[model samples]
Target: MLRGVCTALAAVSATGALMACRSPHEPAPLTVRVDAGSVRGIAKGEARQFLGIPYAQPPTGALRWTLPREPRPWSGVKDVGKPGKDCAQGSPGPKNPSSEDCLYVNVTAPREHHGSLPVMVWLHGGGFTQGSGKDYDAVRLATEGKAVVVTVNYRLGMFGYLGLPGLAGSGDFGFADQIAALRWARRNASAFGGDPRNVTVFGQSAGAMSTCALLTSPAARGLFDKAVISSGSCGLRWPAGGLFPGAPADRPYVPVAQGQDDGLAAAEELDCTGAGALACLRGKTTAELLPHSPSFADHLAYGTRLLPRDPAVALRAGAFAHVPVLIGGTRDEARSFVAGAIQYDPELITARTYPRLLKEAFGRHAGRVAARYPLSRFPSAGLAWATVLTDASWACSTLAGARDLAARTTVYSYEFADEDAPNVNGLHVPDVPQGAAHATDLPYLFDLGGRDLLVNRERKGLARTMVGYWSAFARTGDPNHRGAPRWRPGTAPLSLAPGAIRTVDAAAEHDCGFWATTAR
Candidate 1:
């Protein structure tokens, strides 16, 4: 059963009409009909938000680890005014908790809309172990961009990515859930005043990886007209100790065999390794299963129907869908990850330790890497290490992916380069400049934590510019429109900074040439 809502009324205008601003996990009051049934939502300012409309039935009990089934048809107006619980993952504090019964999509459209507007569906990023669709409030995107926005939540970690030996949806249940949501949006977009034919699927980080998977999946063809990938790339790879002081090398995807191996190992740890193990695994409580979630992170598997091959392999073979793609990443991409490690152990990346760290990760190439990014060239050793990883793992890899994608389709690449971009992740290390690090570009496109963090007028203006660029892309296949800077399609990514938005040689600046000679 769905949870009950606690309502708090807020006056919309001076006319004194109250709008119930309830918890996202609870239901709301306005009604709209879809294929499955009718669902009621809330009138939140400029957007009429259909919070927590189930796209697929909850993935629990007998359904866990299997493909997502279509949502069961409902009778009357299902009160979805309240948002649905987030996917069972490591997300926020207990106040806004996560749950296993999460397979919902929140529709945000103009409160006063003439039907048939373009649709933009969002997939949130939290590695593969954390985060939710609700964390991003799409009011800015809905009203400012004048588009219907859909934010989705899919299963995560063990519940979503676990690949049993002969499971029906091995290694890619989360991918299936995303495809199902897109199918739902395509079917019911007109009910929410959105055009059924025009759809844009965009995401960042893990969400970006999901979008990449969608582009390569035959099952996802025709679901979206265009695609946007941010802070994640088809060729994204991490070297040994690239993420932290001593972390192992990693990539966003693994083979289905590897995924199955990971799942089998996890099941053994849970003592559910015999026949009918899925049923036995499902019998465990949320608390009992969560500790093993991290083990399944970044485990989106290939060699399955949903993803026949790795996205990078598909990109190289030009096997992906031929659609316009907007792909980019922040400037100082790996600063947060490095800073987080230094935060835990303050002396983790000092001058003496930095050289040893690089040698451990890169072996003979350590000398070459250190020669390019000396501590003398940076404010501190931590920043130096971050710069090396950022250029090699993030900026250069994304640029390569963009070039590969552009070989077949229209691809508009960009680099978010705001020097004072807010540290949205809250990871702070003294002397570490968070210059547009990782997800800092998110606030420019969204209001994180339901609060607008653009305190400065200049930053807020940049936010509007970003929203304009994104919405324009959603409306047409191109992001270029009147009043915005000319964003041409090619290899060079448009550098996005206040008063400095223009094409930049990200390869030159990030030293991709040096990395081209080095192992990624």
Candidate 2:
């Protein structure tokens, strides 16, 4: 069997460093010994699942504001067959049920093992507000890809993110949680039939932004060999005296010409102030802190010491991790963001709102980008509006990130344009058809357990095609092979626009001119 050959090779290379093999038992169940304790996971047909393993101590009570501490080891083999309680959150739908003690990682491995398979660590996205790894099931990723799949949960919102003056260091805790999880995998994954040397960190939306942040963070170097960033890419924008876009790089770190909001004053407005700020925050419950969590305009994912001032700046300066990367976004990434951006009114999208929105999001280049993406070019103003938003925020950032990495890393870019693919969320309205909107490609990556999402009949091939590409990438840096169309790595993205998906080679895709003309 494929697994037998791989395990034999692995055993030979490992020199019996791991647990002793069966004196010949009927395919021993996949298991591992982690720092927290030992876990014996069950194998379901083809997938081996180990759920709810803590990567760090529960950050509850006095432990709230401090960096994560190592989880205490357990005395016996814990039954991690089921997931732990999702972090104490606000609500179920809009906001997840989150708690201060939420820090866990779930691992799934293929039943049959090739000694140490590549491990893919996933970070779920919810604007850093709501989302849980528990919502995702990794059975398919493990079996089909012949890889080890790990999903993690980190602190969120006020419990995970509120940056107060006398508290912990600026911006991170959540990212640090991710790093801790990776460290655990580095030390223990081998026992679970995974390669410690070959790790890939991948995520979407805020998760993707977090992964990109890891590329430049000093704390995360050498933890992974490759990265995959989908959708949201972040940078600094300001609203107050605190860190904002345009704050002078020398004294204060922020992006230029981005915005002019008083960040510190705004945090103060949210009641995050003073020396005991951390202590006060720790005393508050998840429910009490919900209202204070930044949303809409106040939400800032970039601009902080942890994020290193500016990602693009660091990337251009070649100050980021030199690793293989796959960066891309859906064709209509902003339709979901539109619910909040336009106050739920699709009709509000116009030449006026379009330009204003651009200005609010991109500063000076707003008008130029508005001109380049005038609503007159599309069937409806709403369509054009959505296009511009997705292209500028998701597509543009994705391509630019790839371009920046091109100098020191192998960068491959793509755009998901499977029009018939079903929208993954119920937010789709009569006015807005969620054509390959954000995260629509996720179900294609994993089995999604039992959750059903849009998958057109003909497009089923596309999902398999994507999984093949992704699994190949996890094993090897390059994402090209048989069973899928030839893919070429380039500084620019290979367009998935409309009908035929074209692989852009040495020549730049339309993105080069799109970004150049859009940038003032």
The most accurate candidate by TM-score is 1
Per-residue lDDT for 241-349 in model 1, tens only?
Answer: 8877777889989999999999989999999987867888889988789888888888999999889998999998999999999999999999999988888888888
lDDT for each residue of candidate 2 in 169-197, tens digit (9 for 90 to 100) = 43456767888888877877776678889
TM-score of each candidate structure, all chains considered together? 0.93, 0.83
TM-score of 1: 0.93
Q: For model 1, what is the error of residue 438's alpha carbon versus the real structure, in angstroms, after optimal superposition?
A: 0.7
Colliding residue pairs in candidate 1: 24-83, 26-82, 27-81, 27-82, 28-81, 28-82
Task: Give residue 109's lDDT in candidate 2 (0 to 100).
Answer: 81
What's the lDDT for all of these models? 0.86, 0.66
